[model samples]
Target: MPLTPIKSDDPVHLAMQGLFPDYNPACLEPAQDLELLRGMLRPRSSGGVKGLVHRSFQGVTRRCPRPLRELLLGLAHRLRCADPELLKEPNQCEFNRLVAGVRSQGSRQRGYAGKRAALCLSYDVDLLSCYRFLPTLLDQLDQRGLKATFHLLTDWEYRLDPALVEEVSARGHEVGLHGASHDVALGYRRDERIAGELRRALRGLGKNVHSYRAPALCMTERLMARVRDLGFRIDSSLPMSSMFHPSTQSCFPYPLEPSGVLWELPILLQDSTLFLDLGLSQEQAWSFVETHLKQVLELGGVGVINLHPSWAAKYSGFHGRLLDAAREWSDFAVMTHKEVYNCCRWGGAAPSAPAC
Candidate 1:
C-alpha cells in the first residue's frame, strides 16, 4: 500500500487532536513531538524512596542522616518531574482547526474495509519455551480457521529455529519482528544504534518480514521512522496504556502521520498486563477481552490483542477458552495482523468465510 496524505477529518487525525489538544502536525516536527511524548509515557521502574536515593547517591545516601536522605529523594523526584527537557507543547488551536476542517469535509474513516469490525490475534514469542507450544497453538487455530500474527524476538539468549519460522509463514500466518534482543530501553536508543539493531533483527528473521512491535510496547518516533524506512509495512507497538499512564488514543489501526506510510495497529488489550501485571484472574482477563471485542465491533474498529506464547503455555486452558469464544463470535473477522492491515489499506471486501 502506498502512503497518502491523511484527510483532515480522518479518525487518526481526530484521534491525534483528541489525544494532544495542543498538537500541531504542521508546526511541530514529527520526530520531536513523538520523542517528547515517548519520554513522557515511558514506563518507570517501581522503586521506593530509599531505592531512589540509593541509586541517585551511589549507596552513600543509605548511610546519610535519615532526614537528609528523605529530603534529597523528594527534591530529586520533583526536579525530574519539572525537567524542561521533557515538556514540549505543540500548537493546539491550529491542530483543532485542521481536524475540524477534515471533519467538516466528511465522516470519519472506519478502520476496517466494508465497515466490518475485526479481531486480530497477536503473539509475542519472547522465550525459547514459548516456541515449543507453537504446534499446539497452530493446530488449535487451524481447527478454528482463525489467522494470527507471531512477533519473534531474534536477539534473545536462546535461538529461534528458522525452520519453525518458515513453517509459520507456510501455514498462512504472519511473522513480524519483535526486536533484536527484547530490550525495554530500545525507545531511548540513538537513531543510528536503533537502525543497526533493527537491521540485525531483520537479517536474522530472513525475508518477507513486514511488521514490527517494540519490546514492552515502548517506541519512539525515530524508531518508527527507521522501521518504515527499513521496509516494514505496519507497527503494533502503541498501546492505550503506557508506562506512565493510560492514553486516550484510539485502539484501531491508523496511519501514523508524518510517518504516513507505516500503519499502526495499536494494541487494544494485552494478556501480560492484564493477568500478570494487573493481577486480574484468568476468568476476569478473558472477560475483559470479550467486553472490549464487543465494544470495538460495535464501533466498527479493529481490536488487536497481545498474548505472549510463554503465558499461553502456562495458562493453556484459559487460552483455549478464549480462542473457542473467538471462533464462535460471528460479527468480527478473525485474521492475522497483515490481513487486517491490508483490508484497512485497500478498502477490500470483508472476509466471507465463517470465523469458525
Candidate 2:
C-alpha cells in the first residue's frame, strides 16, 4: 500500500529482480511465470512418494520427541542458517522486493507518506496454555502504547472461549480466526469440510473479524479461495520460513487474483526459526529480530511479525523493544492487521491497484 523511498542498492528492488525478474506487478499475476510464487505459497499435493515423504515430515514435526525435535531444529539452523545474523535477510528482501516492484512497476500510485516504515506486531494464541500468558503480553503492549493483532481458535473450550476474543478486541487489538481448532491438518481438510469449519469459526468469532490465518500456516490454493469465499478480507497465513512451511519468500501485501480483493499479508521472516527451531537465547534472538526490522524499514515495506503467546515469558518486553527499535531505525506505525487492510484496499477515496 505504501512504498518506501528506494535507493540504488535497495534490497527491495534487488529482491524483485532476484525473485520475480519477468514480473508485471501492475497487471496482477498475468504471466504464467508467476507459478513460482504460487508454487511456493501452496505445496504440491501428495500422490505417491511425495505424499509419503510429506506425511513423514509432518509426523516428525508433530510427534517427535522433544529432544529429537530440538536436535533437528538446531541442525536446520546450522545448515541453512549457519550465520544466524543473515538468517532472515533473504526472506525479508523477498518482501522488500514486492514493495519495490509495486512502487516501481507503476501498480499503485500512492505511497506511504511518512518518513518511517510500517511495523505490525502480531500474536497467535494457538494453545490453551497460551491463555494464561495473554494478560502479561497485553500489558506489555499497553505500556508501550502499541497495538497488535491476535488470532485465536474458534472452537476451543477454554473457560474464556469467545470472551478471550472480546477481551482482545476491547483492548484495541484486532482479532482474527486461527481456525476452528489447533489441528495441524485443519487447512488440508476436504473443501466442504474447510468451508463448514470456516462458517463455524466465523460464528464463534463474534468480533468484527475479517481475517483468517490457518493454524500453523497450513494452507492450499483451493483452501485459500474458499477462505476468500467465506468473506475474509485479509490472510496473514504465509511466511518464508526455513524450518516451518516453505511459504512464499516474500512479505509484501498483495491481492489473490483474478479476484484481487482478498489480500495476502505475508509474515516477515520465521521468528520461529530462531526461537522455536534454533532455541536461541533472548539476546541472540533479539539481535536477529532487530536487524531484520531495520532492513524492512530501510526498504519502505511493512513488517508483520508473528509471536506466539506461549512465548510471552520467554520473550518478555518484545513489544516495547519492537517500538523502541523501530524508532531508532525509521519512523513507524505499529498498526493491527485490519488497519493495513484498509490502507492497501483503498486509496484517495477511490479504488487503486489491488483495491476492491
Candidate 3:
C-alpha cells in the first residue's frame, strides 16, 4: 500500500517533519517514526548516555529554544508509545538502526553483482549431543581454512574446555549466543524466557558480540524483541523456503521487524533437513546443497547453509563434501557470523519499517 501523508499543520506531524527533515512524512509509520528517532539516539547496542544520535537530540537544546526541544522529545515519547514494552526500553531500537546502517553499506559494496553467499555453519551448542562432535568439526573447519560462528550455550560456556572455545575465537571464527537451553518448544514460553536466556548467553560470550541464532530456529516477534532488548544487532533466524534447486533458491539478508535488526542471512538448506525431515541419503543431501548453492548464486543473493555438530557426525563424509563445494563453487563472502551482522545493521539513511 502507498503511504498517506499527514496533514502539515498537525503538531505531531510538524515535529516529525522538522526532526527528520529529509524523510517524507507520507512514508513514515509509527514503527518507522520510533526507529528514526531511536536511530537519532544511539548507534551501538551498548547502553549509556554518550551515543552520538542521543547527543544530536541534545543539540536541539543548544541550537533551538528550550521549550522546542522539550516539545519534540515529548512528541517522540508519545509517538514511541505504541508498544509499552518497547517504550520502557528505548535503547534497543536505536541499536538496531545503528546496525542496519552498517549492513546497508556492505550490501551496497556487494552490489547485487554476482552470487555472493554467506554460509553460516551455526552450531547451536545447547545440547550434549551437539557438543560431542566439536573436536572433529573444528578440525574440519580448520583444515578447510574456513571459519564459522559457534552459537554456544551458557550452560556449556564454562563446561566446554576453555581452550576449545578460545581456539574457535582466536582462529578468527565468530562466536554467537544460542540462548542457554535447547528447548524446541519455546514459542509458548518465549515471552517469559527470552530475556533471561539472551542476557545469560551475552554475558557468557563476553560483551562484544552482537549476533544470535535462536536455539532450534524457534523464534517469534516477541522473542526477537527480547533479543533486541538484550542488545543484539543481527538475528540469523530467517525462515527456510520450501523450494530447492538452482532456480528456486530465494534467500537474502533482510531486516526483521519489531527489532529492525538486520537478519544476516536466512537458513536455506540445513544439513539435518535431509536426515530429520526429507530422509535423503548422503548423495541426495549433497545434491540438494549443491543445487541450492547454484540457485542462490544465479539469483545473486546470499546462500545460507546451516549444519549441526551432531548432524556432521552422523553424516561424516557429507560434511567434508559440503564444505568443499562451498569453497570451490560459491562466490559468497563466507562470513564468520559476527562479520555478517556488523556489516548489515541500519545506519546511513533511516530505514523504513521492514517488509513483512
- The candidate that wins on lDDT is 1
User: Residue 347 CA error for candidate 1 (Å)?
Assistant: 2.0
List ranges where model 1 is wrong by over 4 Å.
1-115, 242-248, 349-356
Better of 1 and 2 by lDDT: 1
Residues 1-356, model 1: lDDT tens digits: 23345455344443454333244445333434444343323323333452343334535544556467547644544443223232111112222233334434443534443445788889998756677778788888889887899999876745878898888988989898898776655555578988899888877887567678987665666676687777777788876443332232445566564333467777777786666555678788787677777666655567788998778878777788888877887777887877776666545543332110
Residue 25 displacement in candidate 1 (angstroms): 15
Residues 1-356 of candidate 3: C-alpha lDDT, one tens digit per residue: 34356654343333233223243444443455444433322212322332343445544543454357447745644443232231211112232233233334332223222334456566666556677778778888888888787877765323656677777788877766776544333333446665666666566655356667765565555666676666566666643343211111125454443243544355666664556556679998888677766655544445567777877888988888988865665476566555554444422233332211
Query: Estimated TM-score per prediction?
Result: 0.69, 0.73, 0.61
**After aligning candidate 3 to the native by TM-score, how far in Å is the CA of 355 from where it should be?**
28
Q: What is candidate 1's TM-score against the reference?
A: 0.69
Candidate 3 worst ten-residue window by lDDT: 83-92
Q: Give a tens-digit lDDT track for model 2, residues 1-356.
A: 43334343332333343223243434343433454655554433423443354345546665555457547645644554333433457334443454554556554332343434567788887665577788878887776667788888766534446666677878888877787655455555578987887777766666557677876676666678787777778888877444445556655566654344677777875456656666877778778777776776666566788887766666666545655664454476677777776665653132322211
Question: Which portions of model 3 miss their true places by more than 4 Å?
Answer: 1-115, 156-158, 190-192, 242-250, 257-264, 346-356
Backbone clashes, each candidate: 4, 3, 16
C-alpha RMSD values across all candidates: 10.9, 7.5, 17.7
| TM value for model 3 | 0.61
Superposition error at 15 for model 2 (Å): 14
Q: What is the lDDT of candidate 2?
A: 0.61
